[model samples]
Target: MSYLLTAPEMVATAATDLDGIAAALYAANAAAAGPTTGLLAAAEDEVSRAIATLFGAFGQEYQAVVTHAAEFHTEFTQALAAAANAYAQAEATTCSALNTFETQLQALLAPLLPNAGAGAINPPSITSIGAQVAFIMGGTGIPDPDPMYVTGAQTLFIQPRFPGFLSDALHTPEQFWPTTPNLGNLTFGRSVAEGVATLSNALTTQFSTLGNSAVVYGYSQSAVIATIEIRHLMAQVTPPSPSDLGFVLTGNPNNPNGGVLQRFTGLYVPVLDVLFNGATPPDSPYPTVIYTNQYDGTGNFPQYPLNLLADLNAVIGIVDGTHFYVGLPPDQVANAVHLPTSPGYTGNTDYFLGLTQKLPLTSLIRPIPYVGTPLAELVQPDLRVLVDLGYSDYGPGLSYADIPTPASFLSVPNPFAVSYYLAKGAAQGVQASLVNLGWLPPSYIPTGYPYAPSVAPGLNFFVGQPSVTGLSLLTGALGTAARDLGWIPPWWD
Candidate 1:
């Protein structure tokens, strides 16, 4: 990615530019000292002119004048150094001024959308199969206008709200976790779980008339929340609904607990815990696909800890059931899962499988003897763990591109800074203007368990894949929904 600003080019360019200015100043100072050179050269003229009048007297005088010229030369050299110093100072000032201007320009022009907000809705009728989606935005702290504004069009109808947190927290290396326990006393890794729950509850009552296939997608923390909520949603349905696709947690929460915030929360949930209901609500057996960015942070699950490869090989078919390695078979996945706005395919099935079902990163060490024989026997030898691209603090890469206009101003860093306030005022101002609108039918809750995979090929198959697109996933999904509803798309994107 072009994200590695640490490369030498920028530094070299800045250094060379400053040097060029200094050299120019030195040349200019030398030119300014041209009068001294002329005077020295004129010695012959002065001697010639003086000899015609008072030759002997002028000889001593001219010699004395010539002798004093060395002092002038010394002064001239000093002036050259002074000129160079001044040039350097001027260059420094110019750089500082430019930096200040850029910072202010970004502040004034830096598009920042609100991270999260709520608005009253006038329900749209669902009239088609394509419109049956229940667009669920992913986890915490992503502002409006962010890239993830166009997620989940096939499932739920959505208008993304701002997440209200810094983009760096989602993508940076700083590790911070919430104080509360998530699900089964396990400390959830990121902030989106709460946001998802909040958003889901708000929509639950309003969306009862929407369809059954609740497609939740969000990158980073939002993904984690979507996964948890899908479990909850599945549990709420009797025998579960057929439409529940669960969560598409792009950038699988870093292995072990996943996500940068794992360590702070102090909750140690194993990767195996996700497959079963240990402490969370009605246990969810629904289908979920966790997507990971190949170039994600070192906390990236499959490559985590030094012994990752050996550990998986050693844990293969262990007794604790904690280390059973498996991969999602292609038959189980829908086009919706494979064909989102962006798709990443490794082409190596075994490698994809290893990453998809590999164990989560944890501090706990499992002994070889304690593993259950059945769990050990079930381990697949063909599993291919994802290729680790080394650790990175920059999460999955997504940054603002091309400067924007009202189209641009809206793209500023925090537009939703005003969303809460604007939503309160514009609530009524925007209602009467809509002309034509598209709608889908309300959902028919399907019978049977929603948690199980829709297609069961055999014990040889698993169908979930992990892909990471960072926080843009949620922002993009929500943005698409907001545009559909006729709101000015927030500028943060």
Candidate 2:
């Protein structure tokens, strides 16, 4: 079941939490500069690490400063949370003020939002493409009347979490399968297989009434499931019943181990053949788009440490030509008229660094909320105020079914995804889609940083002329995937 939190509820939770974090910061500063100082310094280091991680292969001097600022914010919040009533209340008041200030700031930019209009990519048919474990639902929302989109489509968008997200979301991004107790408990492939299995079973009966619907393998993660599951399903002779089959892989990963730590190359060959071997019509046979980001760390063959993975992601794909195509090239960087001719020469590192510096640290690090407060509010309540409504006891086995979907996840108010994609230099069509769908700023144009067009107001990340074209490939692949799924125009031979 999905639930929506009011704007006030969201603000209140954040105000309360920020109040706590502010107090923590003050305490950390005032308290003994020994242990507290150590913690503060560690946080600073962590922030630096996070910043460096964002750069991929490039690092900058400001990145350290940004890290320090983030750490300070974290320490402040932690200290504030631990403070007594006097400090906590004061901190809360300060947070309230900040919230008010933030509100006014947003009000100023409210006009930039897309004007309400009919959405894009409406599905025309419900082509059923059943899989054994789960039916993959693409991540990006598809508009109605789009051939691929079935009104109440049931699909899964599952993939391994990026490294940064591990620290950002799961708390331990480094812990691979069999490493961390909670995460490692289940086999990586097994979990995906299970999700597919359950989806297939439930969707079979659900789609019966929905019409001749199909399963869409969307996004890198969804594509991962589709590729792996297809390989597994192909092993069986009579692979269950199905309405219709299609694998609309957008920005699809050619290999299971293509992400961080894992780097298997040429793994997507079979899956590519399965979808686009000229066996099916232009739209049929599951269109797959191997999206490659020219600026993506993976674009540089030697940059990604693919050998680190124990078994998966063992092989490496070529970047320019020899590579097993994964994403788009650095079109964003290539368009830059004035390239950063810094001391070092070559590659997209210079461009990426330039862009990284543009995003301010203050925007990236979200303030921490109060202590003893609900976990939902303590971590970024503004994104979506999710006050725990008596749903905690279910410890380890917390599935999507256990919790309600927030308005933000289902209907994200902000276009963080679009902004990020734009920064990466996505295709004009995809950018247009984002703008048309009210996903991003309408006037936002893809240009080489420093010279290319204007930057969006209120964007925290600094934008130097990006030297990478990763965004181009990434957007192109995603666009291709969207087309395959009947969200955009079909791909031509």
Candidate 3:
């Protein structure tokens, strides 16, 4: 027996290219029609007339042949395009049917299968090609009304919401993580541990199968589980090769630089049952991609916690729903910034930083009627500069492991740039405030010192150097007064 494999998208693209070629040929043939088919006699003589007549007949014959060829080309192109569409539709239908069948089968078999329930692992159906991909869903506590279980009689009622973005990204069948998704303080650790075990077992089983190869995708809490699994795999004496196994993680809490876990390493909150699990292994041999969204408190936390403003902003980001990647546009996710890895780093891990256009702080403030948006615009740029200082910018060939410590207290790597931004921010703030107060016309374009002029209108503002400097001094004075009055903690720095 033999099977055929086809990529409908590739076929469609090929058809489009062929259609363009056909169009070009048709135009060329049309242009040549008049000159070739209706040739004029060079001279009013027998010889010229005879020659012209002969060539004209040949031209007409050639044109007829071309017409037949063009007709065939059109038919072929149309058939190819139709075939592509049919294939695409068939694939979609097949995937849908398979998923539905799997769900039905699991429900039917539940009663007969012992210990087969929500936590039961579904073994991968190995293909002749020997490679497979699995998608592990993120954590959630919501109970599913339409429950699909691996076993009967035992109902866990713990089915998490499946993210559409993950489905779009991974065009494959999904494998549910066999763990409780509840984030309640008492259950969080146990749920995570179960997830880790389930994933590890599934991967191990897949690897043990003859000629089997696999790639696993993990999101959110499952990403943490994946990280632990990767560590476990690496620790094995005969670990699977990069070619055999790979990993993809999104919104990973174990992200090296910005992960909340890495930021507060070794810290344990008694009631919360949250332990900073430390960073994912950057030196792992298996292929991996870790994606972190900017200002997502779990994945992208501020390095300097002492910067209270930045800390507050990060918290607001999490609260404002930046942590969720549910409805993010695919293009935005695709266009994530590729973060540079450390020099001499032999690890197969790559990091991507998803940029957030609207500051999370702005989202937090933009709901207070008329004043909300304008006030957010007025203060965002200046506040952005201050908040940004909390993060250490890694240039080319730098490690993600440069974790910030309390010893680097209030460290300003470049005082000049800081001073310049402070002045620029102050200027922008003043201009934005004036605009909000109706002192400046809406059409009046203010200078965007720290950013581009093409940035959103209200986001750009400017003021004089003297005023900016005065404002900076005033801010400093206020800070000093707060500290002296014991309003600011002594050990905060």
Candidate 4:
């Protein structure tokens, strides 16, 4: 029972008289200049000269005004067309929803009715009414597709690294970020670098097969992998357009590469900004999230390779004459990166000041550069953009979770999870999916659902179990963690 509203019919037709008015005005002016055969005797002779000046000025202005009007008309027409298209799409979605609800309501009510007579809310008539919401079939023109397109709904979820004992030797840059599409070996499991490169290759294939763009999510070492994946895509001659990509980053190591963020807009939570002295650049469509929570002790672990000297970051900060991870006050939660978090160094004030308050003095071992650039600089720009986006009050929800004691930092995962949900919350598109799936709870859920488990379908972390020399271990724990966090598939022996 829908009816269309029509515009009021009482308006005057002034637009129709514009041409007639112009013609009359022109004729009147032209007639005034006719038959100037005899010159005026004295001062009156200047009338024709004055008329010529007035008409000349008016004609020049008139031409300019006409050009401006045409430009305005073009802009307005385009705007109108865009508005009409949006209206049509919205109307169709709403109508379909209403019809479905109506059909369901009728089915329920029909049974309750004691008298199912022809005049008593007939279901058949309602079905016919629903059928009337059909497409108009008379248009002949086909419009060109828009140049900037964000087509299809798909997500690319990247994962962070797990806690493990490793070394600076594991920073195999060549294997992690290969220049060619022919991905190198698969058995380089000593570092997250190899894992990331393998994952990148698989993701490219998966994205292509889906025929859709993706929303990449990453944290810690995995954050590095996420950017690398984008790099891989851009290297192609016909790279995927930026509109097709989106990011949901948290605790990333470096400032996100502007090359990608400028194109694909998304949420960036630099929960780990201290590593690169808070580098959040301003080149994103959305505001970045600056998160620092009490329980994230990982920041305290001097982002130098896991097995490299623990206090190496502090040494560099001291040598550089300023804190490398500068800009945080002692009271803040993110300042934990500046504070030493190991059990031995927890209560030691001297250790907090970058000295050997409770160590074997083993930090003298400084590792050589593998990837490129000084280590800190490499990690700086990647996460700096996150800081810059949040530099003003550190973006929305820009406060710390204040852990009661520094002792509970590593054990409690809640602080990190809090910021993780915040990142997802900022991505409205991802949030919509959660609302539809009913997985999001009022209370916090410890496990994160791997939106797409097979994102890196056949990624190999290390070639294989030591028993098998160079064979690809199709089933690996790291890849499983990358895919699904809510409930990971069991690891193979």
- In lDDT terms, which candidate is top? 3
Encode model 2's per-residue lDDT on 1-493: one tens digit a residue: 5522122222333446676665675565445333322322224577876654555323333444545765777666555444434444553564466445534554554454221121122122223433222233432121111323321122111121001000000011111145335544433333334445544554455446533334443343344445454544455575423334334343333321122212222111221221211110112223222222221222211112222321111121222222222222334323322211222112111111111211111122323343212222122212111111101111111111101111110111224322332333323334433443555553432233211222121222111112122432443454456456654311111
Output the worst ten-in-a-row residue range by lDDT, candidate 1.
400-409
Candidate 2 vs candidate 3: which has greater lDDT? Answer: 3
Error of 1 at 46 (Å): 77
- Cα displacement (Å) at residue 421, model 4: 30
Instruction: Give the alpha carbon lDDT tens digit for every residue of 349-448 in model 1.
Output: 1001122222222112222444332222122111121111111111011110000000000111222212222232232112211110111111211111
RMSD of each: 26.1, 26.0, 22.2, 29.3
Tens digit of per-residue lDDT, candidate 3, span 46-120: 999999999999999999998888888888999999998997788567546644544455457555432231111
From the highest lDDT down, the ranking of the candidates is 3, 1, 2, 4
Tell me the RMSD of model 2 versus the true structure.
26.0
Error of 2 at 413 (Å): 42
Q: At residue 319, what lDDT does model 1 achieve? A: 22
Task: List the candidates ranked by TM-score, beginning with the highest.
Answer: 3, 1, 2, 4
- Tens digits of per-residue lDDT for model 4, 1-493: 5533111110111222333455555554455433232223344557777766666666656655655655565555455555545644654554455445434544565554222222111010111111111000000010111111101001111111111111111122222223212444322122234435555554465346434443343333444444455455556786544433444333333332111121112212121111111222212222122122211122222211222332343234233323111123324322222221122211101111122111112122224343222232223322222211211111011111111111100111123322332343233223323333454432211111111111111111111111111111222333344335423212110
CA lDDT, every prediction? Answer: 0.30, 0.29, 0.57, 0.27
- TM values, all candidates: 0.27, 0.25, 0.54, 0.21
Question: What does candidate 1 score on TM?
Answer: 0.27
Candidate 1 backbone overlaps, count: 88
